[model samples]
Target: MNDFKQELIRYPAARITEVAKALSGDLRVRILETLGDMPMGVSQLAEALGVAQPTMTINIQILEQAGLVVSSPGANREKICYVTCKSILLELPVKTGDGLHRIEQIHMPIGMYSRSIVRPTCGMAGHDGVLIGSIDDPRAFYMPERTDASLLWFSGAGCLEYLFANPIPPGVPLDELRLTAELCSEAPSFDMNRQSDISLYMNDMPVGTWRSPGDFGDRKGKLTPDRWFSGTEYGALTEWKVTKDGGYVNGIRATGTTLGDLSLDYSEPIRVRLEVGKEAEFQGGLNLLGSGFGDHPQDIVMSFVRSIDRQ
Candidate 1:
């Protein structure tokens, strides 16, 4: 039990549609059911299920790419398949829209940060109530098990980036993009005097930087676990929105970067990074709080807004 692991795979609703396709066929489901017990070679699986090996291989490939299963070569070099995670969670929006709905939202876990360069006082906590690794160790931040983190915090200069999968269908131009999160300044245990300038970036382009008032320790966060005490607890639920007008944080104009400035209609995923660099004016560091450790109930939420007023 000393070795930590994550057995949950979460997907956005839009992307879930793609994954749902893999599970649509009965043959694929059967293959999955069989793989759940143990890993098997493609030929062995097909024979046991009384299906053609060629047909089985096709279905298995789809699940392998969706991260539902892992396939490898065996002694005879035949492909072996094994289910990856114990469970899969698909996050669906509360509402669906085709005409009136102009926004698409996706939540990215704090631990799923694709890139980072954190310094001392940095650490992460999994939902299980155990710290992933020793604090202040940048190497620990790269642990594969960090995906289970409910909260990721750090002191000093560093940046955490997430490659957000755009939900805006191809060929559709976006008029606005908004990112919302719960964050506060990092203090030794807890200090109201600490202030930090947190910057937001999209695909290496600077969106804006806002000054956090102080490290929050006012009271225990509603979702904070018993293991955490006297540390930064909660944060202001702020929204950084970039629209055709400009970039606005909490309804206050923070950056003039317009919607057109980002050219987000690309094939690659959207890159969003939150940073508090070493050279920052107020380098109080950052406490990027996620659900179960913050006042908020969710992690980083991104929404794509398409305005019909213009299009």
Candidate 2:
């Protein structure tokens, strides 16, 4: 229960889904319980769970990602791990003056874009993990089944736009605005060195830019399809939050543009755009990961964090 990380967490409401996903696995839960009283190595956990070392590693990674576990280099090249959360309590969204905030979230499928401008080296995949058309074809993005896309990627100057029904409470001014998505740099094939400057816009105003380090190909994505090949295996799940001060990427300050700068209002559906600026220093491409192609289990997730009892 040495959950110092969670105890002093700067943000909690925003991470509920990640924590839930981590606790969803039966085996992961067992590992966490086994490490309750003491820290152990990967091999020890595997032996205790009667699973292979690789399987244990993957499960441990998920736990680490959720911030429920911590791992450090042990003696003799072994990795020591321990539980980070003493306890977890789930609460229904409550309205009690300023003590609590409720977050409203929605997911947008990859192909539900209201506007799509992409170049060659682009295509969409459905829930079945099959490509809608040949690469370098824009028409593939318009396929009817695109609503089922579990993953999407593109290169050169490109972007996919989406609309979200306004969820801001009538009387509550937004306290924070955020967007979460799994993405990576796009390469012609599987080059791991590719990079891209991906940007996000609200109501046609730029909020911030995230510089993707590379087109990831280190290993196959946890949910990636077995048939897909010669391309990226997956990408990184990034979170961007905007407030009065500015825009933050994964909790780090990224831009000076504040939420008010985006001009979001309840009068109409919010216009959300994900794009790779052609003028960006790195125009490698864009890989918008979906449920089947990234570590996260969500599509384009947008959040409107509002004070339930704005007084």
Candidate 3:
């Protein structure tokens, strides 16, 4: 087993190419994709794909050689094959800006909070009081150009803000502003119909608002980490925005300043804020997974762009 693991892990680029060439069959990609989600026996895979067991085994061997799949002994000593690769992070050969057009990517782990409470959620705030973290914790502190964040908490009626010090160059028209965060319910108990109303503000004006649903509080979510996803809970990747016309969510035009109603003036500092509150009759609280939600938190990504035509 050790030799097998080492051989798979320490393969040189030339060896990898040789293995790829060996497995370059038409049905190999489909077989790998099917096995990527879970492990399965050869008989089961062959039956599902309407192929003979021997034929399936031949393809599996090719995939295993390519280091794209792994096989092990299963129940009753049957052979089980599974995919080991998670994702493909590739760097494209493209030219960007010299200095000012640099793009920075940062990753922040969540689930590191020891203690969190409501009424003051975690968020990013600028030196000039622009909030960016969560809505309830409007006074959260943040630094400029930093992407990953570990915010604390937020309540029913509060806001979190983040400020970007990189001033918008004068005479440059702001092209777009976007904000995204993973949200879940913080309650110990589950409640259906639990909702958290969030709003985005720019320079103290309403930009957009999104109503997020809390988990059933019964079990953890599917995509969350093991420690966090084990319980009966639910959350989602929520985003909203403001445009020249109005606010929108997932592309649908939303009425009111739900986030799409405001615009940024690149000629000055960019201020972003998040507001959390209860709808007229809904009841729920939010657990914001910033840089401190779980064992593997997410770095909140915020972008402020200025168009060349606007300049």
Any residue pairs clashing in model 2, and if so which? 1-86
**Model 2 residue 288 lDDT?**
86
The candidate 1 region of ten consecutive residues with least summed lDDT is 93-102
Worst 10 residues of 3 by lDDT: 95-104
Candidate no. 1 TM-score: 0.67
**lDDT measured at residue 38 in model 1 versus the true structure, 0 to 100:** 75
State the lDDT of candidate 2 residue by residue for 138-166, as single tens digits: 88887787778887888876888999988
> Local distance difference test, per candidate?
0.80, 0.79, 0.51
Off by more than 4 A, model 2: 1-101
**Candidate 1 lDDT for residue 55:** 87
Candidate 1: where are CA atoms >4 Å away?
A: 1-100
| lDDT for model 2 | 0.79
RMSD of each: 12.9, 8.6, 13.9
Model 3 error, position 14 (Å): 34
